[model samples]
Each structure stands twice: as C-alpha cells, then as structure tokens.
Target: MTEIELNGSSAGLSGLTAVPWKNGSLNEALACYFCPQKTLQADRPKLGKVFTARNLSRIAGIEIRWTTNLADHLRLVDDDQVVFIFHCASFLQLQKSLDKSPFPDSFLQETLDTLALLFPSSDNETTNWLKSLTKIDPRLARCGSLRTRERRLENFNYWHDQLVILKQAFDESSPRNISQWWFDRRNGVQWYTFWIAILVFVVTIFFGIVQSIEGALQVYLSYKSIQSG
Candidate 1:
C-alpha cells in the first residue's frame, strides 16, 4: 500500500495522533483511500467484486472522517494512508475545471501518472482505484465548497420568506385575491374570457358617455340659435 497526499499539509502531519486500522500497513492505506467522509463514503456504494482485492474487505470497517479544513484532515493518522486534501471552492467553478480537463484526458492522465508513481503498484486492481479516484476529483468539484452551499441555503430562505408573504396575500378574501390565484389550462381560458368581457364593458360605457355628451351639446346649440333669432 502507498501513502498519497495531494497538495495536503505536510506540516500538520508532525502533531498528528494515531488510529488503528487492522494490524497491517497495507490495510491502513486502503482504509485511508476509501475514508468515510461524504466524498469517500460516496465511493463505497459503487464498489463491487471486481474493483478490489479479497483482503481489502477487512479494512472496510474503518471509519474515515470528512473535513473541509485542517481539523478534519488531521483526524486520520494511520501509516501508509492516501489522503487527498481537497481545496473547497464553488461547485460551478469546480465543474468548469472538470469540463475543461475531463477524466483520462491528457492533463488528468499526466496527473494520474504522478499519483501512480507516488503509490507504485502493478496490480490491475490499482487501476480500478485510480479510476475511482479520478471519478472523485470531478465529483468533489461538483459538491462545491462550504461557502457556495451556505449561499444556496441563504437564497432558499429568502425565497421561502417571499413565498410565505405571497401565500398570505393570496389567502385573504377580496376582489384582489382573484388575481393571485394560480391558473391551470382549464381556468386560464375562463380568466381570459373574464378580462375580454371587462374590456368590452369599459369600451361600451365610454362610447355611451361620448354619445350622451354629443346630444347635450346639440341641444345647447339649438337653444342658443333660438335666443339669437
């Protein structure tokens, strides 16, 4: 087994405490590689009979802590562990990076080559693990940094408050309430007809008023002509 740390803090390793993962170092490395944080735990559901050695199952019981920072990173302290210290950033940005450099591409392939050199293994099993890890780089990017998650949460709350106010306004019984009601296809036709009827009524009333004013003006003109005669 190999110990791989990517852009991980080497300085923090000095003050670390130890944890048990079987009696073997190889097992310990496997445990760290598939640590139980959300990203690591996410890998487990996909693993099958083809991906790992029979002995790998023994280390599966180990618990890997997930962290967004140093405290979470320091929690795993087994020898020969492969630790990937991911820098949390916007999921959107991470996704963009992934899209620009997809898995097994030239840049990613070169990156994996360096990782393979760090971990040195000839077993085809190692390829499976690298493939899985490769899948993870992009996924972690998609999961995003903690800040983006918080902003999404804040946005949800703001929209929720606005919706609540809209609902309250909608529920109150008044002529205005009719405008707030949601329209379905069946009701939309009726709503359109109602508006058309109202528009026609307004036009008719305006025409009637204009006709009445015209008649009154004519009568006044006739009376003025009689007075002049």
Candidate 2:
C-alpha cells in the first residue's frame, strides 16, 4: 500500500500529511487530484462506495468537483477508478434531470463530451458496463456496444434508447422526451416559455388595436365625403 503526502499550503513535503488507502494508493491519488486544497492531516473521511439513488446528486457533485480540479496528475491515477467515478457522476446527472423536457442541449452536449474524453478507448470497463446493461434490455443493442464511440451521438434513436434504458434501470419516475415538452423549473425552461408566450400575446393585441384605428379612420373619411356630396 503506497502512501502519499498531500500538502496544499507548502510546495515541499515538510508539512505534508500522509494519506493512506485501504486497497491501494489510487484513492489517495484521487483525493490529491480532486481536493488538493482540502487538508487530510488527521483521520480524514474517505469517499465510500455505498451509493444509492437518493445520494446520486451528491455523487455527481463530487465528480464535478473532480472534473473542475483535474490536472495532468490524472495521467497517474487508475483508469478503472476514473471510469467508475465518471460513469456514476454522468448517470446520476442524467437521472437527476430526467424530468426536464427535451433536456438542455448544452448540458447533454457537455455530458457527451466528457464521456468521450474520459472513455476514449472502447475496450474499457465503461463499454463492459454497457454490455452488461444490455442483458436487462435488448433495445440497448441499438447503442452498438460503443463500437462507434467516436460517433456515439450521431444516431438520435440509439442515443434516446440508451437514455430510456438507463433511466428505467435507475430512475423510473422521470419523464421521457415527448411526455414533458414544456415546463421545467430546474433549467428555467418553463419561465422562458412563459415569457415568450406573453410577448406574443402583447404583440398580437397591439396589431389588433392598430388595425381597428385604421378602419375607424377610413369610415370617418367616407362619411365626410358623403356629406360633401
């Protein structure tokens, strides 16, 4: 078991605190890589593997933290652990925001980009996980087992099917794309739609008023002409 000392306050290893891992030094490496500013001097709390549906958001936050703090040190960590963490984070993010109709395009694109970056190779544990998931739903066969990892998002139907399969497996209550096309409080989609509808209504009323004023003016001119005749 390799132990590494991580010190945020010092460039040298003088006041560094030694952090040990149960299995290997991968956990320490991850901690150093993600939370370099957090001091792990005394018996610091470790990230546990006991994840549940209720804790998905928290897990996603941890993963996001890792991504934001990522540096070249990522090359030194275990790929398997990295894949596991990314999968957990990405899946949880999708699950948490499933209620949003059509989904935010930016969010979806960012998630896909992160996936491509993290799982550049198709022969990794992530692909194997997807394969195992196929046993539960044959429809996931459309995902192609990541054979075309580079063009994973090209097939809309396949990508949608993958989302449906994962959602069913993890979160059942979230709405599908077509079901909730309008309101989404999380991403402020509902507010944007509401404001757009109000603007359209106001413009229509203004046009109607202008048309009425023109009709009244024409009628008055005709009456004046009849009087002159």
Candidate 3:
C-alpha cells in the first residue's frame, strides 16, 4: 500500500500581519455603501438608500457640472460622499476570508448599527466591499462560498449586475455639487414667486405702519380741534 500526499506546493511564509480596518472604520469617515450581502446576511441595516452622507468635491482636471434638479444634485452628492469615504476610511481594506470563520456577528452588528444611523444616503462603498470580499472576477461572476452550481452561478450574475450599478454610480461624475432649490432660474414661476413674496412682505409691513401712523395723526387732530374750540 502506497501513502499518497495531497497537500502540495506551499510557499511557507508566515507572520503577524497588521490588520487594516478594525471594524470601527467606515463610520469614522461618516460615509459608505452598505454591502448588500452583509445586509442580507446580517440583517443589521434596514435602509435602502445609496449613500451615508453628501460630499462636495473638486478633483484635479475634473469638470463639475451644475445640475438644476436639486434632487439629482443630492443623488450625485451621495456618490461624492461615498467616494470620499472610500478614500478616507480604511473600512474595506481588510483581508478577505483570511479567518477560519465568517465575519464576527458582533462586528457585523456594529457595522449594521453604524449604517442604520446613516440611512437614506446612497453610496458605493458596500458595493465595492462585497465585490472584493467575494473576490469576484470581471470575466467571471462567482461566489467562492457557494457549492451548488445553480447558487454559485446566480450569485455571480447578481454580483456582476451589482458591480455594474456600483460602477455607474461611482463613475457617473466628479464632485462639484450644485443645488437650485427655490432659486431655479429655468422656472420663471419660482423667480416670480420669490419676488412676489418679497413684495407681499414689504407691502404688508408698509400698510401696517401707515395705518398706525394715520390713526395716531387722526387722534392728535381731534384733540387739537377740541382744544381750539
């Protein structure tokens, strides 16, 4: 009987590598994209928004456009914030699956709680984190954890689509955010309404003062006439 060895080619190099993100990072930047997988798996975040905060950016050589729609500007602000967060925070730089077990439940809960406090802000951080953790290939959408071909393929396709959305949102534009809420020039109505409000305020104040002065003058005149009589 011949004993066959299975565990082969091993580059034996080991040391205590300093961990980058120590779980309290993403929230430190005050912005991030919540991972869909983490959210689904941990059930920590209950929000559906894209970003955790709004950011203004003026990167070198990037032309920032002014958007008339306040809502759209805010949507892009979310993107800017996410990108800024990614650059500033050490959240996603952690070693993927280097542990024997999945991410700690406590860590996941902490992340979820942090994100819960930052709901309604859409971001691409989580999206990027998921792609990295899964080690997804652009050419191959795959979940390394899954075993069944059906589940693996589905996850791969799903992640690929998510990556597309994440890229689109992140790569849409440069920072320089502009919001025209009540001051949109394109809407003549808003302009007219603004002036009309000012006019109304002035007129109301003017009439009120005039009425008081007139009443005082009338009373003075009556007293003077009585004294003269």
Name the best candidate (by lDDT). 2
- Please give, for residues 1-229, the per-residue lDDT of candidate 3 as tens digits: 0011124422222111111233455333122222233212312112223222221122211223322111121122333333211120122213233353233433333332322222212234433533454322221111112222322212322122332333344334332322322323334675578668878999999999999999999999999999999
What is the clash count for each candidate, in the order shown? 0, 0, 8
Model 1 lDDT per residue over 1-229, tens place? 1223434433334234233234456435434433322212121122122221211211222222333332232232343232323222233234346744221233233222222222234444444443565323333322312222222212222122322222222222223233322221224575677778888999999999999999999999999999999
Model 3 global lDDT (CA atoms, 0 to 1): 0.32
How well does candidate 3 score on lDDT at residue 70?
Answer: 14
- Give the poorly placed runs of model 1, Cα more than 4 Å off: 1-186
lDDT of 2 at 208: 100
CA RMSD for every model?
A: 21.3, 17.8, 18.8
Q: Show pairs that collide, candidate 1.
A: none
Point out where model 2 deviates above 4 Å. 1-6, 10-68, 71-207, 223-228
